[model samples]
Target: MRKIIFLLFLIPILGISQIELKGVLTTGNSGTDVWEYIDPNNGKIYAVVGGNGMSMVDVTDPANPVEVSHLTSVPGFDVKVWQNYVYCVTGGGGTAQIVDISDPANPVIAGSWPSSHNIHIDSNGYLYASSPGTTIYDLNPNPTSPTYLTDIGTEGHDVTIRGNRMIDAHGFAGTYIYDITDPSSPQFLTIITDPDITYHHQGDFSTDGNYLYICDELGNHPQADITVWDITDYGNPTKVDETADPSATPHNLYVIGDYAFTSYYTAGFRVFDISDPSTLVLADEYDTSSATGEGFAGAFGVYPSPTTGNIYINDGSGLYIFGFDGLLG
Candidate 1:
């Protein structure tokens, strides 16, 4: 384990916060999305850092994360973990790399894909690679060498799976839903669109799966922050509510239980109490960047670990680990 300089209590740049900065690691490269993986053999948690390339950090100790290994074979703009494997992409034309991380201390590239923009692995161990559009691959038998399954030709930016549902965020096309009960053949459900939608970047479902929350990546667009929809009727999604911080650009969103966590480009990491979708409340916020005005120059990604109870976020500076003590029951 390398010597990790812990920046224990750095104050937030903006409002009072219920979040505490535990530790951080400067990856040297501007960071993007991050994925967590718990080593089954040892039960140690690791954070796969994405950016120009990808690196593995032992976050089992949140106060002192140690960079264990890394791979520069591909530009990792997005990353996801399934079992003992990692799927990553450049969000461009660069080939996607499949890494075997059975040993967190020594990860190795096991295989490759033609290209990918984003990657997601469902509970069934199926890999959904968004290469502008969407392509499904089976990670069964061997996670590294994925077997081609099917393709949803609807061009999109990202894809997410929860239970039997799949949500594909398609910029101006809005968000599309599909029945992924059969991972190989996704049956199109319906497309959720609203006149105010600028860019459907990414989103997550509420705990009950009756509501959907989406984030629009356009910073300057009016009301493009976060939008909520009543997804109880898959064929007819109704826009229920919305919330935004006009000064920042919203990126990705992830939901766990009653809270929705988001990464704002210049605003930093924000947590929303989604118990009432119609009236989402800002539970806690911590500005991770000093740069003012939004143009994608701040927190790039955020991941609230359900297992470790630690929040991981990446900014232009590097990775910041935090613990959120505030939550509205």
Candidate 2:
């Protein structure tokens, strides 16, 4: 009884010592993508959730996110915002759900393209969809519809684009980098693989684009390390740093400046300082669960809104919005 009383007292103190939770907003169900877009017309940011069809959130008020419109029955898997329109795929259902967000409050289907697991867009309004292998499309000619451009015979779980450089995390097989300077014909640059990097779940690049930070997932247990690599040289990726949580599996992550906001399935949200490539310092953490021990039952995705540094996360239960106090020591 004495130990129990002491532990209960320590819990709140530990929580208070960690990061600040500004506010959390959730969806009707679990959502994987928190797609943010700035209204070219008004400049107010809206978060489009990809889960059950889609949910439009007014994140202009980041603290109190309100779901103004949603399509709960469609069950969307991934989404990418382009030219004020949303291109999404119905995960297992296979079809693109093109939504027009010009109204913000009420989104209507603009059109549909090839459905995919993951969708990546460039500043040029071109798109790369991970339909297992990659299929490139041109949304420039028609914002409502896409004209198929090309397809790359490669498969991946997720893909990220920076400039003309693109990479696909193929899971267990590692990642492949590509030169997409010409969307009509994307050149495969190289494949990165490491014994510890099997099941390359998700990855993001450093602000300068010289480094690639990749994280393994729930598939390859024990290989939970969020491994870092030096990608200055295209074909050769050199391993640099690695970090992990013994109790939880790391999921999606987004970096803003030198800070990394990562989600640990059972452990909740974590903030890391990546200013120094040699060492990763844990800046703050917020555990989403009070249940004993751990095993994949908490936050799975996190999005750091570009307009406002406020962070948003979605667990299996609901969506949460948080405020990040920059590198608070």
Candidate 3:
């Protein structure tokens, strides 16, 4: 049950020297979901932020992003980019929006779904959305028209699909796993809970799918900021490790290669070396907020570009970009 904890909200000391800030594209007072889209026609990458509406940023020049387009819609809480379309999910009795990104500069709303929130698109082109229950959508061949597949009874704070299994990080209710092979008819498998966990908000599987990184979004005193589970067996997940800073509240997390990136609401951005999940180490961090008690006024989500390895972070204030030379291995 060992963990790493600290309290610093402004330019916290760098744990390593490899992390760097390349550029930033600032947006007005907005929060939640930072996703990236790469234009296939011109090879230019676009950074998409969801809030108040959808803002398309040309991160082609990481240091100087041009806001080519802004499509006003419901304030979005989550955004996903697949193929030539950008999918945005609005929480709080919101809808899902599908925008065609074939032309990054002129994105048009392709389609939308009613009653959707916090949607996750899997590798097989299946969209998993959460509300009181989980709703599945199949987006293939054409991104605009997503066919509703099935719905699961159990509700989740966040959901992700890997292969035929669905991982649901259900706060208070713990983490639940489901068999999603049937897409339209999912069956509950198991639920894993830890005594020290407060709120299980979201989770990300390791590259090999052997471990699950769970984020705990505690408002006041934190029990654990992140609880790692050995999910080798989906039926029975064992608590392997945990990490958190003093007075920490984690928001979103994404894993890439040997590293896992997280955005702590007040603690700013954190990078962890997950080569060894049993003894996860804090790799690096960048602080963007001044408040420290974790009341949701800092980094909201971290999106690392698959094409360029640059990190895109969205906070309540603005959007930022960070870069790394290479792994510390």
TM-score of each: 0.90, 0.85, 0.88
By summed lDDT, the worst window of 10 consecutive residues in model 1 runs over: 1-10
Model 3 segments beyond 4 Å from truth?
Answer: 1-17, 27-30, 219-222, 326-329
lDDT of 1 by residue, 141-226 (tens): 77778899889766778887889999898877888889988888889888888778778889888888889888888736567588
Span of ten consecutive residues with least summed lDDT in model 2: 288-297
lDDT tens digits by residue: candidate 3, 28-131 = 42478888887778888878887777888888888887788887864567888888888887775656778887887788888877656588888788888786
lDDT score, candidate 1, position 291: 75
Off by over 4 Å in 2: 1-19, 27-29, 219-221, 289-296, 325-329
lDDT of each: 0.80, 0.73, 0.77
Name model 1 segments beyond 4 Å from true. 1-17, 27-30, 219-221, 325-329
- lDDT at residue 323 of model 1 (Cα atoms): 82
Choose the strongest candidate by lDDT.
Answer: 1
What CA RMSD would you report for each candidate?
Answer: 6.5, 4.7, 5.3
**Top-down TM-score ranking:** 1, 3, 2
